[model samples]
Target: MQRKITPYLLVLPLTLFLGIFTYFPILSSLDLSFREWDFMSSDKPFVGLENYALLLSSRDFWNSLNVTAIFALVSVPLRLCLALMISSYLVREGIVSRLLRGALFLPSVTSAVSIAVVFSWVFSTDYGLVNGILAAVGLPRVSWMQDPQLALGVLIAVNTWKQLGYDVVIYIAALQAVPRELYDAAAVDGGRRWHVFRRVTFPLVMPTTYFLLIVSVIEAFQVFTIVDVMTRGGPAGATDVLVNMLFRIGFSLFDVGTGSALAVLLFIFLIVLALVKAHVLGRRVHYEA
Candidate 1:
């Protein structure tokens, strides 16, 4: 009895913390999704799915969902592929590899807001570094964040650059865990480099790939800070992601109920995505590596 009680006591703080901060907010959001209440209002009226109905029927909601889906679909694969390729080169233990790894990973640990702010300057049209270089080469200055056509793409590029380092680090760990015997066997069979990687390295790294796929997709969907800091989802609502839409609806417009409904929908979408990924890719993840 004493040992059991001790274990529970040790976990009580964390349990309470999660309950108060995470679980309670989730429950409140779910409840609020069905009710109409501005943040300052004391009288909360139950609207009974009206919020969800409005959210689902709104063009803004569909636009946000489409934008988020495009971001996730494009950025996740690019990040994973680029990370895997870069990590393959940086896997060896050497002074140069160590320095490169550290440099690559620095962005991951840096503040997302800070990164966005810096990138805003970097991509600015008039006095930006990129524009300066273009001018130096006698090229045109491109409006990266202002143009509706290019804003989302700029967001994707910034996000990929910021996230690539973390993915590379994870891939490096996964690559290092792979048994050398398999590569040796492939080499003994006189397999070409690409063939060896295709048959041996990739198959073994499927578990890590699957893990990163889920996480990166979720992160991409929930991305808000960069869009907020840089574009504010501007230039004809081009970069308005689901999370940014949620923020605008909930906090900016004071439409708490609708925002909560959007949040719930986003949550459900993410859950469904995870389930689909598990069903499709889970079986292919070989843990034996």
Candidate 2:
């Protein structure tokens, strides 16, 4: 009996932790989404889809959805492409390469708020480093964060800078794990570098790329702190991503039930997107490599 119980005992702590923190919250959110209540209210009246109805009809919600979609679609590809190329170069073992990887990855470990704060100054219209360089070059100062046309672009740049490090590190690991024997074989057959990479390296790295795609998409949707710190989804609501709107509704406006409904919708949207990704990309991932 002792031997049989040992495995269950070992797993019990983790199970309990998840139950308390993860599973319970998800269940609570689901329940809350169907009811109307403020955070302080004792009475949570069952509204039964009213929150969802409002969200689905709201123009702000749709705008947020569009902005989030654009952000994810644009940023994910840019980050992944740059990370892949950088990792390709940095994959070789050397002191300089290691140092560069550490430098690049510093941003990933740093606080998001800290990064946002620094970038706010960097992109500031007057005293910013970017504008200073523009002045030096005799170019007109551009409103990076203040212009409605440019605010989302600024956020995208900041986000890309912050996330590049982690993606590069993961990509480096994936590139390194690629069997060296395969490269040697390709070289023996006189495979050109670009051709060899296209035929072999790219295919082998598909699994990593697929995983990063899913994670990065989710990150893009949840990009609240940087937006809040930098633009507060402003310059005429041009940068109002979904999570920012959700936070505004839930906490800032103190609309608990509506916010929960929005959260639930976001959750469901991500789940459907993930399922679509798996269906489309899963077969292309080469686990063996």
Candidate 3:
């Protein structure tokens, strides 16, 4: 009895915290999805599946979902590949490498809103550093965040720049943990760089890659701050992701029921995504390294 009580006590703080913050909110949101409310109303009435039906039929919700899927599919592979290549080079430990790692990770620790605000100016058509370089090379200045065709791409670039540091840092740790003996054995058999990476290094790093894939996809779907700060889901709603739409519905429009429904949908989508990724990638992950 004493041992069992002690174990429960050890986890009591975290259990209580989650109960208050996470579980309660999730249950409340699920309950709220079935009720109509303006978030300030005294008389909250049950609306059944009316909110879900409206969201499913709404063009804005579908558009936001489409944009979010595109963002995740494009950005996840680009980030993973880029981080892998960079980590391959930075795996060797040295003073310079350590300093570079810290410098790279600075963006991850920095505020997301701050990064968006700074990049907003950097990608400005006039007096922007990016356009300034293009002009120096005798090219026309281009509007990055204003055009619908280009705004999503610019947001992806900024997100990638802000997030790449974390991926690189994680990859470096994973790469370093890979057994050196395996590489030596491959070299002894005359394995080329590309071949060795394909067979050994990459296989060993698949677990990390898979983890990052799931996280990055979820992040992409839930992206809001940068979109809000820079585009406000505008330039014709080209950059409007799911979280942006949710915020607009819940906070801006004060439609709590519809917003909760949207949130529930987002949660279900992420759950399905994680299941699919686990089913596809779990078998390929080599834990022996």
Candidate 4:
């Protein structure tokens, strides 16, 4: 009895913090989703799914959802693939590899706002670094953040660049943990380089890949800071992601109820996504490494 009590006591603080900061906001949002109240309003009135209905019917909501889906679908795979490739080469022990790893990881630890601001200038139209280079090469300047077609792609690139380092670090650890005996056996079996990688290295790294996949998907969906800082949902809502829309509705517009509804919907969508990924990919993950 004392042992069980002691374990529970050890986790009590964490449990309390989770309940207060995470669960409480979630429950409050759920309740708010069914009500209508601006931040300044004194009397909150229950609306019985009206906010959800409004969001479902709104063009902006659908557009935001589409943008967010595209962002996640494109960025997650790109980030993972690049990270895997980079980590494979960087797994060797040396001063250069260590230096490269630290340089790559610098962005992961940097503030998102700082990254966004720097990128905003880098991709700026009139006096941006990119345009300056293009002009120097006798090419026309291009608007990276203002064009509807290009804005979301810019956001995706920025997100992938920022997240690639963390993924590489994780994959490097996973790659290094793989048994060298497997490689020796493959070489003895006359396996080609690609064949060995396809059979042994790739399969062995599936667990790490799957973990990164889930996390990257979640991060993609919840992306807001970069979009907010760089484009603010863009010149015509081209880069308006779900979370950005939620922020606009909830905080900027002060439509607390509507914002809560969007928040709940986003939460539900992510939950469903996680469940689907678990169902589809969970079995393929090899934990033997």
Q: For candidate 4, write residues 138-208 as lDDT tens digits.
A: 99999898899999999999998998999999999999999999999999999999999899999999989
Q: Which stretches of candidate 2 lie over 4 Å from their true place?
A: none
Q: Which residue window of length 10 is worst by lDDT in model 1?
A: 280-289
Error of 1 at 284 (Å): 0.9
The lowest-lDDT stretch of 10 consecutive residues in candidate 3 is: 280-289
lDDT tens digits, residue span 124-173, model 3 = 99989999999999999998888999999999988998899999999999
What lDDT, from 0 to 1, does candidate 2 have?
A: 0.94
> How high is the lDDT of residue 198 in model 2?
98
Q: How does residue 242 of candidate 1 score in lDDT?
A: 95
How do the residues 147-183 of candidate 1 rate in per-residue lDDT, one tens digit apiece? 9999999999999999999999999999999889988
The digit string of per-residue lDDT tens for model 2 on 43-114 reads 999999999999999999999999999999999999999999999999999999999999999998899999
Query: Model 3 Cα displacement at 169 (Å)?
Result: 1.1
Q: Which pairs clash inside model 1? A: none
lDDT of 2 at 14: 100
Sequence-dependent TM-score of model 2: 0.98
